[model samples]
Target: MIPSLGYAVLLIIGSFVLNLVVSKIRFNRKYKFPNVVPGWPIIGNMLDVPYPAGMWGVDMAKKYGEMFTLNIGGRRLVYLNSSRVVTELLEKRAAIYSSRPYRPMMSEIMSGGARIVLMGYTDKWRNQRKIMHSILNGKQSEKKFDDELLNFILGYTGTLGEYQFNPLKSPADVFTWLSRLPKPLQWWRPFGEKFCETHVAMFQKEYNILLDKMNKGIAKPCFAVDVLHGAAKKEFEISDVEKIYTWTSLIEAGSDTTRVAVLQMIAGAACYPGWARKARDLIDEVCGQNAERLPNLADRSRLPYISAVVKETLRWRPFLQSGVPHTLTQDDEYEGYKFPAGTEFSWNAYSIALNDKEYSDPLRFEPERFMNDDLKLPAKGHCRRICVGLNVGANNIWIAAACILYCFDIEQDPEHPIDQFNTLWEEPTKPPFKVRFTPRSQAHIDLIEREGNIALATDY
Candidate 1:
C-alpha cells in the first residue's frame, strides 16, 4: 500500500512538471504570427505520422490543408505545400529562410561540410555554389566535354547505367560488368558507386594520377580542369586542402544523383513498352539505324519521343526523396499555428511529384502525362534551387537514350509482365535487372560491338 501511494504521488508530480515545461515554451502572439495547428505532448501530432513511406506527407497535406504545424520529437515542424509558400521561403525571402535543419547524424559524420545540399546561406556556401556553377555552367560543360567526346569514342566512355544488371552477382563479376558496360556508360567506365569502399580507394588513386595527367596534357580536363585551372572565380580563393573537400562534395552529388536517374530510366523503359517503342522509332528516323556517329544534343529535336523518355525518367524517380531539411530561423506564426524557431521542415520531392491530384495517373508510367499543358513544369518554389547540371544531365540522357534505341531494342522477352516492373517494392526486381535490352538483330549487335570495341587508353 505504501509503495502504491508513493508511485501515485510521483506520477502527479511528474505531470505537473511536464505541464510547467510545456507552458514555458511560449508560442505567443506578440512574437509569432497567426498560428493554427495543435501539437500533442512530447512527440506532438507528428507521432501520428507513418514513416519509411513517402506518401504520408501528401496525405497529411490534404488533411491539414496546404500549410500546417506538426510537432515531432520535441521540435516543431512547418509543412509548406502548394507553390506559393515554398517560393516565399526559398526565393522571395531567400536569405533568412534558406537554412537547412542539419541532422545530428548527417552533420557529425559527413566530411568537410562535404554537403552543399545541407549548407545554409553563408559565405562558404556561396563559394561552393560558385565553384559548381563555374565548372558546369552554360556552354562550358557541353563544349569542354564535347571536345573530349571524340577521344573517348576512339577510346571508351563510362556512364552510370550498367550494361546489364541482375540479382546475385559475385564482386569479380561486378567489376567485369563495369569494365564491359554498354556504350556511353563505357565512356564513364572508371566511375562507379563509392558504396564499395574499395571502389573509392581505387577512385582516389586514379583521381590524383588523372589530375597529373591533365596537367601534362596526357588527358583532357572535365571536372578537374576547371577547378585546377581556377576558372571558379572569386569564390574559389581557398587552399588545395579545402578545395579537396569541396571537390569531394561535388563528386558525391554529381555521381550519385545521376546514377539513380539513369537506373530509373532503365526501369521505366522496360515497364513502359509503348514509350520504349516510340523512343526507338524516333531514333530510327533520326539516326537511320546505321548512323556513323552517336546521337548528340544537336540530334534531340529530330527525336521527340526519345527526349520525352529522358525527361520522364528524371520526373519519375528524382534523385532525392527529400532535400536537406530546413529549420525556421525565427519564431514565426502563421494561420493560427505558432511555429517555434529551429523547427524542422523537409521538402518532400517524391510526394510532390507523384501526387495523384497533381499527376493524372500517379502510379502508371505514362510519358504523355507530362505532355499535359499545366503539368509541363513543376510548380514554383516546389523544387527551389533547380538542378545545377540540368542541361548536361538532359543532354547526356537524351544522347544516351537515342544511342541505345538506335543500337538495341529494350524489352522483356520470355518473362511475365510482373517480372519487368516490381509494383510492391519488396525484392524490387533486383534493382533494374528485371528488364533487359537485347540487341535487336545481328546488324545491331555488330554495330555496337564494332563501335564499343575501341581500346580504352588509361594513361594512368
Candidate 2:
C-alpha cells in the first residue's frame, strides 16, 4: 500500500512538470520574440521582473540592447529602451500600439475601468481622449491653465513633493499578484480604495457644481464644462462615475507631473549653483532686472535658456519613469522579432532619456543639451497616446522655473546637504533638503509680491 502511495505522488509530480514544459513550449511557439529571459516553470519571468521596473529596465536595456521581452505570469511585456525603437513602435505604429494592457485588479476592481489612463483602446477611450485634447491641446490649452493660475494652484495646494496617487505602483503590484489578494490580507488595498473613493466623491461634487454653473450660463471653460456640455449634446454617453474618473485623471496628470518637474528643477538648482547662476543671468537678460514684473508666457520665446532648463529637468528625472505602457492590438514584428497581439509595450524613458549615445554625460543635469534643437521630451510620452496636457505642462514648468530663478538664488543649505541621487526613487520628489532662497535684490522681492498679488486676484 505504501509503495502504491509513493508511486501516486511521483505520478502527480511528473504530470505537473509536464504541464509546465508544455505551457512554456506553447508560449514560445506562439510568440517568437527576442532576448527572452528564461523564468521559473509555469510563472515565466514573474520572479525575474524586478520591483521598481524603471530602474531595473535601465539595466536590462544595457544588457539586452534596445528591445527585450519579459513574461510575467503568462503576460508578455516588451520593453522599448531606445528612442529609435520607442518612436518606431509607439509613434510610427500607433494604431497597433495605442491600447492599454488589461489589469483586472486596478482597472476593473479598484477603478471600474473608469480611469482614462487605464482605459483600453476603445470607443470610450477615444472619446475621452478627444475631450481631453479639446481642453488641453493647441492654443486653447494656454487659456485653460495660464501661467498665473497654474502657479497659484501649485502654491495653494502645496502639491510639490507630496505623495498623491501613484499610477506606477498599481501596475507593478497587480502584475506581481499582490493586488489579487483579499482586502483584509492586503495592506495597500484599503488605503487605495479610500483614496479612490475620496477622489470619486470630489469629482462628483465638482461635477455637480459645474453642471449647475452651466445651467446658469456662467460656467468656466474647463474640462468639467466640456464634459458636461458634451453629455448634454449627446456627443457621448458617460456615467457620473466615469465622468468623475475622467476629470480626476486629467487633474492628476496635469497637476502632479508638472509639480514634480518644478521640484526637480529646484533640486537641480540647489545641487548645481553654477547652472542656476546661468539660468538666472539668462532670465535677467530677457525679462530685464528692472522690469518690475515676473516673467510670464509672453516672454517665453525670449527665454530660451528657461525652456532648456525645463526640458532638461523633464529628461533628467521623468515623473512617469517608464511612461505609460501601450498594448499592441495586432501582431507586429520589428528587427526580425515577432511580437504577438496583446503584448504590452513600455517605453523605458529612464533608459532612453539617459542614453549616453543621445546625450553626452547623460547623468549630468545640463540644460545646454536642449538649447540648440527641439529634443523630444519623453516625459510627455510618445505617439497617438502622448499626453494631452503636454503644452500646458511645458508652459507651466517654463514659467515657474523662470519666475523662481528670477526671484531668488537657490543654494544647498550648509546644515542639511541633500542626497539628490537617493531621492530619485521618490516617484516625483527629491529627498528632504533645506535650500537658501536669498532674494537677488529687494527689487526682485517687490516684483514677485506685486505679480503674485495680481495672480491671486485674477481668476482663470
Candidate 3:
C-alpha cells in the first residue's frame, strides 16, 4: 500500500511538470512580445505588479518601451502604456479587442452576473449599453432636481462608498479556482452573498423611490426616471435585476470619478492659486464680478479657460488611472507581436496622460497646456465599450468645477497639507485632504443662497 501511494504521488508530480512544460511551449509560440516582466516558475509575475497598479505600469512602460506583458499565473496581461497602441488595438481593432475579462468573484457571485461594468460582450450587454446611451446620451444638463432628492442621492452615493471600502474577505478573487469550492468551504461565499443582498436592497430602494415620484408625476426628467418610465423600449431581455443595477451603475460611474475630478481641481486650485485666479477671472468675465448668476451650461463655449482647467484635471490624474481591462475575443497581432484569444489588455491612462513624450510638462498642473489646439486631451476609452456616461460625466465635472471656482477661493489646510498623489485613504475616491471654500464675497454668498432657494422651492 505504501509503495502504491508513493507511485501515485510521483505520477501526480510528473503530470504537473508535463503540463507546465506544455503550457510554456504554447505560450512562447503564441505571445511574441519581447518585453515580458520576469517572474517565478508557475506563478509567473504574480508578485511583480505593485499596488496602485497605474503608477507601477508607468514605471514598467519606461523600462520596457511602449508595450509590455506580465504573465500572472499563466494569464497574459498586456499593458499598453501609450495612447497610440491603445487606439490602434482598442479602437482600430475593436472588433476583437472590445470584450471584458471574466471576473468571477465580482460579477458572478456578488452581482449574480448582472453588473454592466464587468459584463462580457454579449447580447445582454449590448442591450444594456443601449439603455445607458438612451438615458445618458442627450442634454442632461437641463434636467434639475430639488435639494431633498439631491440629499437622497448623496445618501445613496455614501452607501456605495461604504460598500466600496469594505475590507476584502477573500484573496482567492484573483485565483478563481478557489472560489469554486464546496458551499461550506467557500470562505468568500457569505461575504459575496451579503454584498449582493445589500446591493440589491439599496438599488431597489432607490429605484422604487424614483418610481414613486415618477408615478406621482413629480419626478424630474433624469436617468432614473427615464429608466423607470421605460426609456429603452427596444432593449428587450433586460431583467428587473439588470434594470436596477443599470440605474446604480450609471450613478456609480459618474459619482466617484466625478467627485475625484472635482476634488483634484480644488487641489489644483489650492496648489496653484495663480491658475485658479486666472480661470476665476475668465469665469468672472463670462458671468460677472458680482456673480449675478452661477455658471451655467450655456457658458461652456464662452468659458474656454474653465474648459481647459477641466481638461487638465482629467488628464493629470485620470479617474481610471489603471483603466478598465479589455479582453481580446480572438487571436490578434499588433506591431509584429502575436496575442491569442482571451488575452487581457489594459491601457494605462496614468501612463499615457503623463507620458513626457505626449505632454510637455506632464507633472505640472498646467491648464494652459490645453488652451492651444495642438495639444489634445488623452482619450478616456475607445470603440463600442467606451464609457456610456462620458457626456453626462464631463458636463457634470465642467459645471461643478466652474461653480466651485465661481463661488469660492479654495485654500489648502496648512495643518494637513494636500498631497495630490496621496491615494492612501480608506476610500481612495474620496479626497484625502481638506480644503476651505472661502466665499469669493458676500454677493457670491447671496447668489448661492438665492439660487439654492430657487432650486429647493421649484416644483419637481
Candidate 4:
C-alpha cells in the first residue's frame, strides 16, 4: 500500500512536468520573432531584465537593432527602441495597441482595478477616461499641500516598478491564483490592502472637503469643483467613487512628473549657464528687465526659446524611462512580423529620445535643436490612450521654469557637485542635489516678494 502511494505521487509530478514542457514548446512556436533576447527556460527573461529598463533597452537596441522581444515567465514583451516603430505600432494601429498590459499586483490587488493608469481598455475604463479628460484637460491651478503627498508618490513608484518592468519575479505576479490562498497565508496581500485603504481615505477626504466647500458656495474653480458640481458632472456618467479616483489619479499622474521635469530644467541651466542666460535674455525682452511682471501663459507664444528649453529637458532625461506598457488586443502583423494577442509592449523613452538617428549630438544640452520648431508645444500623444494630463503638466513645467529662469541665476554648487544622471528608485525621481539659485537682480527679488504677497492674499 505504501509503494502504491509513492507511485501515485510520482505520477502526479510527471504529469505536471509534461504539461510545462508542452506549454513551453507552444510558447516558442507561437512567438517566433526576430532579435529575441536570451532568457531562461520556463522563467523566460524575468531575471535578465533590469531596473531603469531605459538604459538597458538602449544597450540592447545597439546590439539587437530597433525591435526586440523578451519573454518573461511565458509572457512575451516587445520593446520599441525607435520612435519610428513606436509611431507605427502605437499610433497608426491605435485601435489594438491602446490597452494596458496585465498587472495583477498593481491593477487588481493594490488598486482594486480602480487605478486609471493601469485599467484595461473596457467600457468602464472608457467612461473613467472621459471623466478624467473633461476635468484635468485644462491648465492646472497652483495649490499647496503638505509632505503627505510624497508617501503616495513613493508608494506608487514602488508598486509600479513591481509589474511595469520585470514582472513575474514573484511567481504570484503571473499566477494570480496564489492570491486566492487564505489571507493569513498570502504575504503580499496585507501591504496591498493597507496601501489601498490609505490611498482611498486620503483622496476621499479631500473629495469630501471639496464637496462641503461646494455646498457652502465657496469652492474654487478647480478640477475637483468642476467635476463635483460643474456641467461636466452632469455630462459624464460615473459613480462618486469613480469621480474621487479619477481626480486623484490625475494628481498621481501629474504631481511627481512635473516636479522631476522642473528639477531637470534647473539642472540643465546649471550645467549650461550660457543657455540659461539666453533664456533669461528672451524672458527679459518679453516680460521686462525691471521685473514689470512675471512671465505668464500669455507670453508663452512669444518665448520660443524658453519653450525649447522645456522640450530639451524632457528629451534629454525622460522622467519615466519605460513609458507605460501597452498591450495588443488581437493578433496583428507589422512589417512581416506577427504579434499575437496579449503581447505587451513599451517604448524605451531613453533610447528613442537619445538615438543618434533622432537627435544629433544627443548627449549635449542644446535647446537650439527645437528652436526652429513650432513655439507652441502641444501634447498630442500617440493615439487614443494619449496622456490626458501631459499638456497640463508641460504647461506647469513651462511656467515654473519661466518663473525660475526669470527670477534666479542657477549655478552648480561647487560644494556638492550636481550629477544630473543620478536618480533614486523612489520618489522625487531625481535625488536631491544642491544648486545655487541666486536672484538675477534686485528687481527679480522685489518681483518675487511682490508676487508672493499677492498669491498669499488671494489664497486667504
Best by TM-score: 4
Best by lDDT: 4
lDDT of 3: 0.73
Point out the worst 10-residue segment of candidate 2 by lDDT.
Answer: 156-165
Off by over 4 Å in 1: 1-25, 28-52, 58-65, 68-72, 81-84, 143-207, 231-235, 331-340, 369-384, 412-433, 458-460
After the best TM-score superposition of candidate 1, give how far the Cα of residue 199 lies from its true spot, in angstroms: 10
Question: Whole-model lDDT for model 4 versus the true structure?
Answer: 0.74
- Number of backbone-clashing residue pairs for each candidate, in the order shown: 18, 0, 0, 0
Q: Cα deviation of 443 in candidate 4 (Å)?
A: 2.1
Cα deviation in Å at residue 439, candidate 3? 1.2
Q: Candidate 3 on 242-285: residue-level lDDT in tens?
A: 88877777776676677778877888888878899988888999
Root-mean-square deviation of every model: 11.0, 4.7, 3.6, 3.4
lDDT of 1 by residue, 1-460 (tens): 9999999999999999998777766534334432336766644654364322245655666677666665554555566655556665655655566676543222212223444665665677677678877777677756544222232221211211121111012222222244354545553322223222333353456557757787678766566556666734643575554455455544544444555566667667766677778777767776666555556677755666665666577656555444445767776554455556666565555565666665667556666755544332333213534656565566666666677767766665446453322232212124435556687767777777666665243322
Clashing pairs in 2: none
Q: List TM-scores for all candidates, in order.
A: 0.70, 0.82, 0.88, 0.88
lDDT of 4 by residue, 155-268 (tens): 566555655555644456655567678878887777777777877787787777777777888766666666665435377777766777776776666777777778878888
Off by over 4 Å in 2: 1-20, 38-54, 146-194, 373-385, 414-418, 425-432, 457-460
Worst 10 residues of 1 by lDDT: 159-168
User: Per-residue error at 13 for model 1, in Å?
Assistant: 9.8
